[model samples]
Structures are given as structure tokens and as C-alpha cells.
Target: MATRTIIVPEGMEFIRDELGYAPAVRVEQRLYIAGQIGRGSDRQLVADKEAQFTQVFENLRQVLEAAGAGFEHLVEVTSYLTDMRDLPLYMQVRDRYMAGCYPAWTAIGAASLCGAPGYFLEVKAIAELD
Candidate 1:
């Protein structure tokens, strides 16, 4: 079997040193990005929910770009939210980023997110390479 893997960038050592995981991975025809929160490059959560969501997708965009993929290539999305009330906002954000095609998706409420008070969202994506 052959595999293609993407290692985290330098200074994102937490993904490996702390979390013991890669941020994204590609095997054959699929790219899987790990659940991402609203935290910015500076490691601080965006001040607002909608803004955070935007930043999150932008961050995911970078990850996908690194894997030579795009939102249109996505086939599935799984989102976890700390509050159900944020679902609409989440969908709106998703629409903003996803544009025309809709991928198979599921967004569910969670009791908490990675032990954070302000964070209310985490999203993962699976995209097809062919």
C-alpha cells in the first residue's frame, strides 16, 4: 500500500508533540483534515462566532491547499458545536465558503469543545482527489 501524508508546519509542534497526531493526511484519493477550531494562527480564538467560523474555514483552506485540494473537492463535512444555537450561524458560514455544491454534512451539538469556554465549533473535512 502507498500513502501520502502532510506533516504539520514548524511551530505547530503541538499537533505532534502534544496531540500525537498530524493535522491532515492523504491516502490515495482522499484527504482528511483533522477537526479545527476557531483559533487563529496566533493561537487565540476569534472574538466572534461568525468571524471565528470564517477564520476556521480559511485555515482549513490552507490545509486543503497544502494537500492540493479545494472546497469543491470536499465530499463530506463533520462539525461539532458546543451550542445548538450556533448551528444556523455555522450553516451560514458553511454556505459562504462552500458556494454552489453541497457536500454530505453533519453538525451536532457537543457538551463542550476540547475543554474551552469560548470555543463553540470544530470542523473536519474529507475531500476527494479524483
Candidate 2:
């Protein structure tokens, strides 16, 4: 299968050249998204946990949309959090965006994330298109 990089708009291509990875890569019917942080369009980390969480999902949405997919196409998700105490809040924000379409999920607690120090969480996803 041929692999293609999903083109991201300016200021949002966080991983392409910096991390040596495409923000999202499409291979046939599958779209693999890199871990998304809570950074705003300005490329700065959001301070509030809920706000940051929302931004993370928004970032994911952008990549999916670029690849002609949506939340419904998501098959799996992996999240990394700086604190497990934020799990409840994270789930609440996640449910708000995810609605009833559930996907396989895994959450991990990490000592720190790469990027801004205020970043509390990051999310990675896999989506399958029909």
C-alpha cells in the first residue's frame, strides 16, 4: 500500500520537520495520527487542564479532517498524562467531544512531556476509513 503524509496547515505542523514525523500519515484505508498536545493555534500550550484537553481533541480533529476522516472513523486512541489525578477531568472532556462513538483506549501516566512545561497531556490516535 502507498503511504502519504497528510498536509497540515501553517503553524500546526508541529512534528513534520521538528520531530521527523508526519502529523498524520495515511496508508490505504488507515490514518495514523501523531500524539497531539494542548497547544493552541499560536503554538503555545493552554494553561487550563480542561481547555488544554479540548485543544488536544481539536488538534486531532484537524488532522482527521485533513485526511477525509472524522471521530467516527477512529478505531483506537492512546493518551499520555502527566498526572493520573486528571483522568476524571480528561474523561469528561473526552466524552463531550467523542459523544457515544467509543474507540479502543489506553491511558498512561508520564513524568513529563516534550514541549512546553505546562502541557499535561497528549493524545495519539488510529483511524480506519471505509
Off by over 4 Å in 2: none
Per-residue lDDT value at 93 in model 1 = 91
lDDT at position 4, candidate 2: 73
Error of 2 at 59 (Å): 0.5
Alpha-carbon TM-score of each model against the true structure = 0.89, 0.91
lDDT value for candidate 1?
0.83
lDDT of 2 by residue, 78-115 (tens): 99999999999999988887888789999999999974
Which model scores highest in TM-score? 2
Q: Which ten residues in a row have the lowest lDDT in candidate 1?
A: 7-16
Question: How far is 41's C-alpha from truth in model 1 (Å)?
Answer: 0.8
Q: Summarize candidate 1's per-residue lDDT along 12-121 as a digit string, tens digits.
A: 55776787988788888898888888888887889798898898888788777777788999999999988888888888998888989688999888998879688878
